[model samples]
Target: MEHEESNRSEFLVFPLSQVRKEGYKVTRKAPPSATDWSRRATRTQRGILDGSLGHYKGKAVPKGGCSAFAAQTLMKGTKPHRIRIEGMSITHDASATPDGIIDTVLSVMRYSTAVKSDSDERVKGVKGKWSSCMRKAGFQYASPQAAANDSRWSKGNVPTRLETSVAVADMQCKKKVRYLDTLVDVQSEYERNAIAEQSATLASLQSDAKVWLSNAKDEVNKQPATKRD
Candidate 1:
């Protein structure tokens, strides 16, 4: 390898495939196993997926999911946040030219493939309510997403009359029926509960993370300075 990394520097900056052969092997960890971390992380992530079952799914309480809705909607149409961590360090997320570009392109393509999933199915229950609401307003669609992407309404340069009507109706339903608010509530609540339940495991995961960092430092620092370049 042209370069090697070490835990002394708080990073694992070399190519991943050569890590064990040339880098420190992270063999020590706290009580929780790696499998536990993976399982808990997956459970936590599920609440954030864009589906009906995600979010806290809070019951209607007059303001149903107002906090969750605000959390999501307040940032719409804005430039992305540019916050940097003060102490946290990562070697894997560097925005180096071709790698960064390839990573971004792959991310977008992966999202596009979700077109293979039926939006109505992913957000089924809430979508049913939304469709019913729209039907009452003389619009027919399985989900707002489907209405927005309807091939029948894409003939013009801008929105066609039918497209505009469906979009307006969809928005109205989103607002009037508390569909989005409720869904967000459920998703957020689920995440909160999952985090609370996995408290001990999560703490152990942090210790495991440090072990990884230490191993990387050990591996790279042990190598000669000439080999690092």
Candidate 2:
């Protein structure tokens, strides 16, 4: 039990950003604006003025409420469409444990690797595309690695050891469950102590009885001659 506790204390710390980088990237391209030339001209002007129309910039643009045109198209004369700001979506590998007691550690490592690889690929692809777009837009693009090395990204590693410790503890708990029935059926400490005391008392009584019988036989032998006379 002590050894198990010690093992639990040793955990693997992994960076979360590393895991996210290995996961997939969601590319969201808004539907092309309606084919009306007038609308297109207005959109182009808006994009240029608002920094949305040009080649993609390396920096993310803040998306405020949807445009009135988009709301009107969707609502079609209803109260001005309530514009909602959609949240950014992030992708990552699913967490799963491998079967078999001996395989648990290895399984965790494998899962971590799979997640990291997938995330890395996606991040790389996105960085590549972003870099190209930024270049076209006449903006300098920073490498994903550089961004990841920043304080925020540097802080993303997962606590791999902690995860391992949790797994080990869970496994230990499960093993304990298997023995629960037997443990429940076993005699209580008080009952066992009582039984031991009774056995000792019985043994002492048997010894005393033997001693008393031997003495009685000796007394009878000593009186035998007198009784004959």
Candidate 3:
């Protein structure tokens, strides 16, 4: 905390009371219990570092053909089948085979742990550089994740001055070391390799899913839409 933060004054002068007032206004306009502004703000800061903020702004959500269509239609309450299980209600076409296929696909997707490990290995050098940069900036963080998850910030309704200073240093160090870009490149390479290795299995799954969806479409077309009071 000895490093002179050039912008520390700016954060200190910002009114926490104003932030609380604005948060109250925002929540009144949003659905009850739907928003957590403090957490959202912190996540946005992380997103900027990871480069996922606004990543899909101009992109269309990829449609999964009949699967996507059936999901969207059912979500809109056009689903004809309704059942209760153990006093809890759920809506899904029990006759559809997509559930089994989805479960199988999810089980196959568990290679994420390996992908993360490989990505960490590729960034070891860059991470060391980032640590050195933070040290020079007067922060003692071992990693960006450590700085972002500092326990001190959890006590405040909004980010404190020290947290803001650390976050700025974290981003600056990441930029200096090109940490995020290199991490992304490493992760994408491993992911591509994983997909290539699983190509045959994935292809078989896709083909089976298409056949099931086609049958589901015929069944859906024959059923009358459910009426609600």
Candidate 4:
């Protein structure tokens, strides 16, 4: 599952703004107004996969050979809605091995441990400014994350009057404090330093990834395309 960008002010504003305009009521089952493509796609894929299973369809799933292949290939027919956000793009390939992607992600995450967001003194300072800004705007949240995670909003089906208000103030405060810009700068600096420190390891990982992708594509090309293709 993709992690919600609760700490970032940019991602939450649009959805919360909609809540403000529409007076959307909060419900236990309601998801956040904003969702990223990865999470959206994952949810779509999971739902479709569940339905595609034979047991779920009140029949034994087709057994053996091409039947199994077709079962696994059910998601190839799904088209998910796309959303554009700053510095983001959506990309997917059914032919790609999940293992290859998982391994590459794990390799990158291993080095990422060197730069924890909360441990950065710069982030802490900007958060302080953001807290003060929110206070001036009539909210008492410690940070954007704190405001987003406030438990009161989740306790009832009715929309809290302050949910939209707090979200608006959160976005405004982030702008006033240049929170995203400063946070990005500090994050980029730490990442660059980490890259410099792990240049050889990262390079090897990238090289391996390229080879894996090339092989995956070749394998896909070897398969016969269906009539739907």
Candidate 5:
């Protein structure tokens, strides 16, 4: 009995005779190894590599991603370098140092100061014009709210208003204090002159008094000669 040939038949498969033939060789790429993955990561961190990449915090997948695909999907929604300060938009780059962050904050502060200066100048001009107009009309310009709350505007209640005024007064006081500090640098010169002038005047008066007392003593010693006779 002839056994039926196995369902699988061996065909006469031959390698292409010429190495230069397009189908002569079929090469399969190997899956990335651990070293390959590490090199890829280094390149990415250095911003040399293109396309999406994964980042992990620890042993498990990161909160955002498990692979390049997941990481790319998450980062697509991310906004980079958006910052704000005191209701104003500020531009900043990603920072790796605390000092860089501080610089960004200072930049925002400088911008705010510039804006405040411009506003104050405009307000000053407007207030000056309003004051002049009110003066010419012989009418005082006062806040109706202040008039309604007499206690809030009264001189007798000044101490109670300290809390409200302290902020502005404190700023003025700080400027004065700085001016005083500058004056203190020259204080020694003034003090030296004062001490020298005072001491010289006092010494001259003492010398004159001593001379007068000596003359008086001599006169007293010579007196009463006629009286003795």
Candidate 6:
């Protein structure tokens, strides 16, 4: 399963920007509720984060959501549609995608384990600063995710005033030390390093995507045309 995902990621041409961007850019700047629950939380907000708005496939899935893979894949698909829609009938113009290619352009694309490692490193670097900031603000949380899951706000209810307070405080501390900005800088630096590390593989993927898109267009053109009046 893991190998397949990495292989898929090689074909995945999406950026973190294209990967279902959250309102919060950096992990540390996120609110406590973001970790306590997801933006796609149930009314109770106890379920897992599945990247859906609780309404899916003609059902009110109060507890259900989409997988991370689906979220990443959908974001890549939507890149081509980032244009103004002028009519009810929408036609696809593939040229809108990155370089008019069918695939996405991943700068420092990594899969399963490498991605986990990168995420862990990013958090580990700034987590201490965040902890110190929280301690100064009269809180003793380890990280934002920990603050969100601190069990005080886990009674099948919405984000209460207490959660809101913590979230606000978290954001304040992060901003004070510029923790979020620093974290992004660090992550981007690592991203550049990783891209250089995997330059050969990334280059091959780019070539593959162009040919893949061209083949897709050829197959579409070969299909029979509909009869018109």
How does residue 135 of candidate 6 score in lDDT? Answer: 89
Off by over 4 Å in 1: 1-125, 153-157, 196-201, 208-229
Clashes of each: 17, 23, 0, 0, 0, 2
- Residues 1-229, candidate 5, lDDT per residue (tens digit)? 1112211111111122211121111111144574655555664443322223344333333333333333233223223354455576544322212234345555555455444533454434433444344344443433212222334333442234332332223222223333222223333344444445446433443454455456556656776766563
Q: Best candidate, TM-score-wise?
A: 4
Native RMSD of candidate 3 (Å): 16.5
What are the lDDT scores of the predictions, listed in order? 0.44, 0.34, 0.53, 0.55, 0.35, 0.47
Largest lDDT belongs to which candidate?
A: 4
lDDT of 1 by residue, 1-229 (tens): 1222212111112223333232222211134554664456554344343232334546332222333343233222222222212222212221112223234433433333333222333346666888899999997787665665577654544445565555556555765655555544554454455456546544543454455456556656787878563
Candidate 3 has a TM-score of 0.52
Model 4 whole-model lDDT (C-alpha atoms): 0.55
- Model 5 Cα RMSD, Å? 45.8
Each model's TM-score, in the order given? 0.35, 0.16, 0.52, 0.54, 0.18, 0.49
Cα error of candidate 2 at position 222, Å: 99
The better candidate by TM-score, 1 or 6, is 6
lDDT of candidate 5 at residue 93, scale 0 to 100: 28
**Which 10-residue span in candidate 2 carries the lowest summed lDDT?**
90-99
Error of 3 at 223 (Å): 1.5
- lDDT (Cα, tens digit) per residue for candidate 3, span 1-229: 2223222221121223332333212211334566675466675454443344543446433344333545544334223243332233333353333564456444444355334644576677777888899999998977655665567766646556676666666656766677666665766676677667667656655665676667667768898999999
Candidate 4 Cα deviation (angstroms), residue 2: 24
- The residue-level lDDT of candidate 4 at 97 comes to 38
